[model samples]
Target chain A: MSQADDLIHQPLRLKIMAALAAEKGAPLDFPRLKAITQATDGNLGSHLTTLEKAGYVAIEKDFVGKRPRTRAALTPLGRKAFRDHVAYLRAVVEAAEAL
Target chain B: MMSVSEHEARGALAEIEAVTRRGQTLKGYRYAGPILMVWGVIWFLGYLGMARLSPALWGWMWLALDGVGFAATLLLAAKAPAAAGGAAGQAMRTSLGMAAGVAFVLAIVAVFPKHDLLPYLALPGLFVGFIYTVLGIYLAPRYAWIGVTLFVATLAGYYAWPAHLAEWLAVVGGGGLFLSGVWLRSA
Candidate 1:
């Protein structure tokens, strides 16, 4: 399977993507993403890189004058992948609930 | 730089990428407006709690509850993902640490009263509140109203509850603030 395909199976990564996707506007930075996912840097970044390299998310770089900065946004592919993952997770949750 | 784990390195990349988009994450969270919900609630609960509770004792109980709430906020904040400590984060973090430090000093100072030293408590107390208010209001908008609400709530509690019962209001008020802060900001 492709990287995106592999990604949807991981619960924490799925949650991170879902949170970012749910946001409006550009993208999320490390701290905001950390707050939403409640994941440490190592865990979230490992997942983010996997998505980034797969071309599922894009990273931007620049500054507010002198201040350094970074951000992450889901690519179209990433968004779709996340939705699919959510649906899959929902189905699993529903199935469990039914059982 | 060297201490970063692999995961942190990635987080740094993600955050560096964010700088181009807009304000850093701190500004984004401030504007996100979810925290505003917490802002409104924390104040409202404080208002109600004070209306319900008393004076002198309300001070102590609320003080304890606030102590606990502050601790919990720090704990939750610690759980937050490690973004590379940038200017904003470093400043915010330093100010927060100093604010806590001042409070600790005041807590100790509060117990020690000298005719000459007694006046010194005000310096630390005001200093702690000032740092707190500046962070909540100026830097961290998400939690901006927390300090103000807390201050107002205490005033209200001082007037409302009995001295003995005010302590309970502190516990209840802190719980109210925490729940509302999370619900409104996160939910």
Candidate 2:
């Protein structure tokens, strides 16, 4: 049985992980993540920081021309965790359906 | 480990699926933007040539411009990362679709050889619009918007200003595509 990841279980955080995982390692910019998650800057930033601290996401800040851009990508561990979480969710649904 | 109710789990999974799909569509748009822009420029040039140059020169001009567009598309595809999920397969499918579209257009022209220049000019744009609309419906809503806009504009220009249809296509059809490409790239 797959185990649920508490840190990734939050609705917004799960959305963040899903978006990053979909990129297959390519970094997505902060604005793109904000769009996908539909979260405010502070909320998204805070969740990203949490994922960063948990070693599940890597955040990079860089300058493009004069503009500062922040991008996030799923770490290998994070990708595995996301897959496991998804599997757990599916298992839960399946178990319920089987009942 | 965290405990999630079946309802919560199902909802979370649904959200994840939606986000993942949106991410993939955005990524597809990013990859396709430059290619569309390249075609936009080609259309601009080709229509401009048709408007300005002799009727005999239009064919050669378009052929050359199309060659450039195809080469540019290939180069861009080559530069894109190979690991970007199904990049190669997508390219192959797109290439085949493009070729089939071209062949279908040619066959139509051959079968109906008596058509006026207006129909000939309108055919490509209409076909392109149809393709974009259908693909957009499946892939992204923005594409469908662009496609619909192109389709309506092409017909409007055909009826409203038949004399300057080529120039109108150059500006509206070509320019619309270029602008949409820029917009998609920013997404």
Candidate 3:
């Protein structure tokens, strides 16, 4: 299986990835991403940092009015990895089903 | 060799990109428009079709289905971390809660609704949902298109469709969209 597939298998990260996939464009904000992923800021930030380092997601920071904001979006490699992971998941499920 | 774990650690970013278009973020609502549009239209059409037949029965049924669909969507979307650990694992559960809230807010006006309130309900309900969806997209851009679609369709429906249809549209159309949202988000 590809590395993306293995990472996605992690459950929480998979869903976060999937949730991000649903949007397909635009960066998810910290608070909103937290709400969607049901993750704490620190926890989510931690995961996001991981994703960012992997080059699967891009993180951008800016100030909106008074507050500092951090936003994340999927990178090109990130997209392929997700697709490959989904394919692998399908294969795994299908293979399991065939048994 | 890139062991699956190391490979994932190295390449997981690729998954994020695959799911979302380049240059997209969850903070912006650009992607959330489509699902929202489809959802609004489906609900509006449902109401338009059903209201002409049985208002009272359909009204109650709409409320029930709305809750069912909304609940299912949220249950899948709004999950907390499982001892199962893994961000991927809890992500499914995370969707359920937010999905439920989104669907609820999207469908709330239709529940055991009065015709008057029902007619006026879509306007605010959709507007709020549109805003929420947009925000959600910014948090996670992958599915933001769903929110963007909903937002656009909602505005179109609100501006173009008649008030009478709101009753039926909200119930039936909302139910269908909620179901779709549930399906899409489940995986």
Candidate 4:
């Protein structure tokens, strides 16, 4: 069985990763991400920074018609990690069911 | 390495599912908004023309507007980001679905060649409503509500305001769809 991905194990971070993974390489703006995760601005920002530091996410900043926009996308490494973590979680459930 | 209990694992999986569903819903909204707006404009103009012009002119006007709508929808779908992959396939599917819808409408016209103008106007609206409701059942709940509203509005206009049915459909059916498109775009 694969080990748990500690960085993505947090509930909020997990939600973020799942949302990004669903996009299939499309970048989601910060506000949309926050809405999906239901996280506060400060809390979501801090978690996103952690993911970026770990090279699990790429953060893009740009101006959209004079308004600043922040978008997040899963890095290739992050996608692999998320897939492995999900597999691990499924294994855990299966093991428990077997016992 | 961190270890999680089976319960925790299950919970995490559920969270992932929920977020992924939300993401897919938002994506659907984004893709569908412009297409709906295009059709909304077509409906608005078609009905308005029917209301103001001679019956002889209505058929040609609708044909022109429908052609424009189809072309515009295809262009928008083709230009959408290909990052999700299978973009060409998606566009092909969209074109095929649209062709099917047009063919269905043509079949209805062929079967009922002598229908009244008011009922004719209502038929398309009802068909569109049914389509939207079905899409909502699979894609998002909001679409179902929009579909129901369109269906009800069409029936109400047909029954209550036969004299002004074309105008009523123009404002309510067309305008309602346009507003729904705007609402979905924000989602």
Give candidate 2's whole-model lDDT: 0.86
Residues B1-187, candidate 4, lDDT per residue (tens digit)? 8999999999999999999888767766766677778878888999999999998887789889989988988887776777643444444465567668867886787688665656787888898788878877976898899999999999999999989999999999999989898887787
Per-residue accuracy of model 2 over B23-94 as CA lDDT, tens digit each:
766766777778778888988998988899987787678778877877887777676676565654555556
* Alpha carbon lDDT at A66, candidate 2: 100
- Please provide TM-scores, in order, for all candidate models, with all chains considered together: 0.39, 0.92, 0.38, 0.87
Residue B187 accuracy (lDDT) in model 1? 22
* lDDT for position B23 in model 3: 22
| Residue-level lDDT for B103 in candidate 1 | 70
DockQ of every candidate structure? 0.03, 0.80, 0.05, 0.78
The residue ranges of model 1 lying beyond 4 angstroms of the native Cα positions read A1-4, A93-99, B1-29, B32-153, B156-187
lDDT for each residue of candidate 3 in B97-172, tens digit (9 for 90 to 100)? 4456655655654465665544443554455456546655555543444455555555665567656445534654
Worst 10 residues of 2 chain B by lDDT: B86-95
Q: Chain B TM-score for each model? A: 0.43, 0.91, 0.44, 0.89
Q: Considering only N, C-alpha and C atoms within 3 Å, which residue pairs clash in candidate 2? A: none
Model 4, range A1-99, lDDT digits (tens) per residue? 998999999999999999999888889999899988889999999999999999999999999999999999999999999999999999999999999
In model 4, pairs of residues that clash are none
Task: Evaluate candidate 3 and give its CAPRI docking class based on DockQ.
Answer: incorrect
